[model samples]
Target: MTGTALDAATTELLAGSLRELLASVSAGGELGPALDALGWAEVLADDPATATTLLFTEHGRALVSSRALDDVLLAELDPALPPAAGSRALLYPHPAEGADPAPLDGPLWGVLLGPLHGVDEVVVPATAEGRTVLVTVAATDLAAAGGPATGFDLGSTWHTVAGPRPPGSGPPAPEAWTRAVAAGRRALAAEMIGVCESALTLATAHTTDRVQYGRPIASFQAVRHRLAEAYVAVTAARAVLDAAWTAAGGADGGGWAAAAAKLQAGRAQAQVMRHAVQVCGAMGLSQESELHRHVTRAAALDALLGGHMALAESAGAALLAGADVHPVVEL
Candidate 1:
C-alpha cells in the first residue's frame, strides 16, 4: 500500500480498537487495564502524540485517556494503576478559596493549587510569578487545612490518594502547561465528533425502524432532510478536526486550528444530539436506551474547559491581537 493508504488503514484500525474499548468499558471493565491489555499504554509511552489521536477517535476512549494524561504529564503518576500504584488523578491551577473550583471527573489523588513562590498558605486569586510553586493536598487534607471544597458529579467516584505538595517538586514550564491544555481541548473536539456520529447513527437507525402512515419515517422528505443536514454538520466537524490535528504538528498555527476545530465540533455535537433525540421521540430519553449515553456524554463535554462560544471569543480576540490565521481547507 502507498503511504497515504497505510495511514488510512491504521486510522481505521485504531477507530475499531477504540470502539471495542468503549464497549468493554461500558460493560463494566476497568479502563486503565483494558487500555494496557490492548497495548495502548505502550503506544502512549512510545508515541504520545499518535496515541492521543487514536484515543480521541472514540468518546469513551478519549475520556479515559484525557484524564490519564493529567497524571502522566503533570504529576508523573504511573499509568498502569498497579496495586501499589495510586488511582487516576486530576490537576488544575487551583482557584481561590470561596471562588468556584474547577470541575473534575473520577477520583483525585490530590489537588495541586498554586503559584506557591514560597508562600505557606494559598492566597486568593493566585497568579504565576517568580519562583511559582504548586501546593498539593489530598481531598481529605482540604477539610483539615480548611481549603475550599471542590467536586464534580460525572457519575464516578473520586478518592483522595495522598496529601500536601511533594518535596523537591516545582512549577511546570509555562509553555508545557499551555500545550497540555491545548491538547486537551483538541481531544475534547475529537470526542465531540464521536458523540455526534454515534447520535447520527442512532437517529438513522430509529428513523428506518419506525413506521408512520405505512412507510418508514426515514422515507419522509422532512426526516431525510434533517438527517442529511446533521450528516453534513458531522462531516464538516470531522474535517476541521483532521485539519487541526495536522496543523498541531506545526509550531505556528496549531493553537488557532485547535480552537477553531473545538468550536465547530462542539456546535456540531449539540445539533446532532438534539436532532437524534427528536428523531427517536420518547424512546431516546429512556434509561434503557443507548442514545441517552451519547447525549449525556456530549453535554458533559460541552461544559468542559469553556464551551464553543467561549472558545470562539478567545480565538477571535487572539486573532485580533495579531495571531496567525489559516484556512480550514487548503487548495
Candidate 2:
C-alpha cells in the first residue's frame, strides 16, 4: 500500500506521547489496562512497555541497548537473540517465574520478558536514530497474565516487544525484523509517491512553457501521451499502496498482503519516477532541478525494505504458489 506522510502535528504529538508512554510503561506498574489506552496495545494487563533502542550488529548477532533496563526481567522466549555488545540504561523482560516476589536487580537481567499479545500486533517502538529508548512486554490470552498481583485477558492475541535479546544466537525475533521491513516499506512508498507527484508537476509545467513549432510542447500528442501514461502508473501504484494499508489494519492475514503492496509500490514507483525524469528532459537531470532530488529519493526507496526486485519476486512467487491475494480498496 502507498504510505501517507504523517503530518507535522501528528508527529509532534506521537513524539510527546511516546516519551510519556515510555515512562509509564517502563515503570512496571499496573499494565494491560494502561496499555489499552494507547493505540500500541490492547487487553487488560497484556502489555507492559519494554521499549529499548537496539542496534543490530553483524547479521543481527549482537544487540546493544542504549537505555537501562535494569529494573525489568528478561524472558528470552525466542532464544535466537545474539549476545549484547555495549550497554547503557537497558531494561529487559523475563518469562514470568513462580510466585516469588523478587526485587528487580537494577538495569540488568539474565532472561528477557515481553508483552506476548494484543494491540502492538503490527507496530513496535524503535528509535529513528537507531539509538536508545525504553522497552516493554506482556502476556496475552490468560487470566493470570501476571502472577497473583497480575491477571490478563486470555482470548486476545497480537504482537509487540517485551525485553532484551538473549546471549547466544544472533539478531532479535523475526517479528521485529518483520516490523522493521514494514516500516521501511511505508517510508519507501511515501517517498516514491512524493517523487512521482513532483515529477508529474515538473513535467507538466515545463512542457507548458517549452515551445516547439510555435506552440508549447504541452500541445504535442506525444508529450500528452507520456504524461497520461505516467499519471496512470502513479494512480495504479497509489491503489496498491492503499490496499496494503487496508490489509495491515488489525487484520490477521497481512503477511502476504504486505508483501504484495511493497512489491507493487516498488515497481510502479520506480517506473513513474523514472518516466517523470525522462519527460522532464535535460532540465530534469540538472543538479539544481527538484526532479533530480525526486529521482534520488525514488532510488533510495528502491533499495530500502530488502530491495524492490527481491521483494517483488518473492511476493510474485508466493502468489503463484496459491497464496491468497487481497484486493485493493479505493480510498
Candidate 3:
C-alpha cells in the first residue's frame, strides 16, 4: 500500500519513536507486543505507507530481521491466505528457480528469508496448470523433507514441504500473486534503502576516524569523492522508491513500480557495498566491526527475490510488454 502522505511534523514524530523502538529491537527486544501497544495495527490500516517505510527501513538499518515482509505480502495478496491466527510465512519461489511450482500432491521448493522461531506453516507460491497458486505446507513437513538450506542469512529457512491448503486457497489467483510480488518488491526496496544508509554511515564514521599520514583519511579528496558517490547512489535510489510509491497504482497493474523500485535499489545496494568495503579496508572483515554484518545482509538481500542481472532483464521485459514506469520525483 502507498503510505498516506502525512504532514512532515507527524512523519518526523513517528520516525523518532520508530527509531527508538527499532534500536531496542536490534539489541534483542520483543517486538510483537510492543508494536501492538504502539497501535501498529491501526497505523498499518490507516497509514500503511508510513508503516511500511518507517518500520522496514528501521529494520534494515538495525540489521534486524522479522516477519514484516510476510506482513506486507499478505496484506496485498491475502485473499487466499490463511486467517490471522497462529504463526505462518509466505515463502517466495526460490531465487534460483523463481518460476518453479509445487507439483500437485507434492512439495514446494522455495526460500524463506527470515527466522523460524515459532512459525507454524509456510504459504508457498507455485504454478498449477499454468496458473500461479499458493500452496500451504506444514513447518514440520519442511523439517522432514530437508533441513535448512544453505544461505547467507543464518536465520533464513528453506521451504520444501507439503501440506493441505485451506479450502478455497488452492484455486488459481494469478492477479493476487502478482500484486503480492509487487508489494514484496516495494518492501524490499525500502529495506535496501536502510541497508545502504547504514553501510554508508558506518563507512563515514570509520573513514573519519581512520588516520593516514597523521591526518583523518576522510579529509582526503579521493576518499571524500568515493563516499560522495555512495551517498548520491543512496539518495537517487531513495528518490526512485519514493516516486514509485506515489504511483503505486500504475499502468500494467502497477508492475512498473515494483520493477523500478527493485532495479534502483539493487544498483544502490551494489554501489554502497562496494564503496563501504573499500573504505573500511581490512576492517570490513574483522569481527570487531559491524560493517561485515551489514555487508552480509546486503549480499543476502541482493540474492533474494532478484539480483541486478535478473532484475534488469525482468525490467526490460516489462517495458517491452508495454508497462509504463516513468516515476517523476517531485522533490
The lDDT for every candidate, in the order shown, is 0.56, 0.43, 0.71
Off by over 4 Å in 1: 1-6, 26-30, 41-50, 61-66, 69-88, 92-126, 129-169, 250-253, 326-331
- Assess candidate 2 and give its lDDT: 0.43
- Once fitted onto the true fold, the runs of candidate 3 whose alpha carbons sit more than 4 angstroms away are 1-4, 26-30, 82-85, 99-107, 115-117, 149-151, 154-169, 251-253, 326-331
* Whole-structure CA lDDT of model 1: 0.56
Q: In model 2, how large is the Cα lDDT of residue 192?
A: 59
Q: Could you estimate the TM-score for every candidate?
A: 0.70, 0.49, 0.87
Against the correct fold, how does model 3 do in TM-score?
0.87
Ranked candidates, highest TM-score first: 3, 1, 2
TM-score of 2: 0.49
Which number leads on lDDT?
3
TM-score of 1: 0.70
Clashes of each: 3, 56, 1
The number of residue pairs in model 3 that clash at the backbone is 1
**Which run of 10 residues does model 2 get worst, by summed lDDT?**
52-61
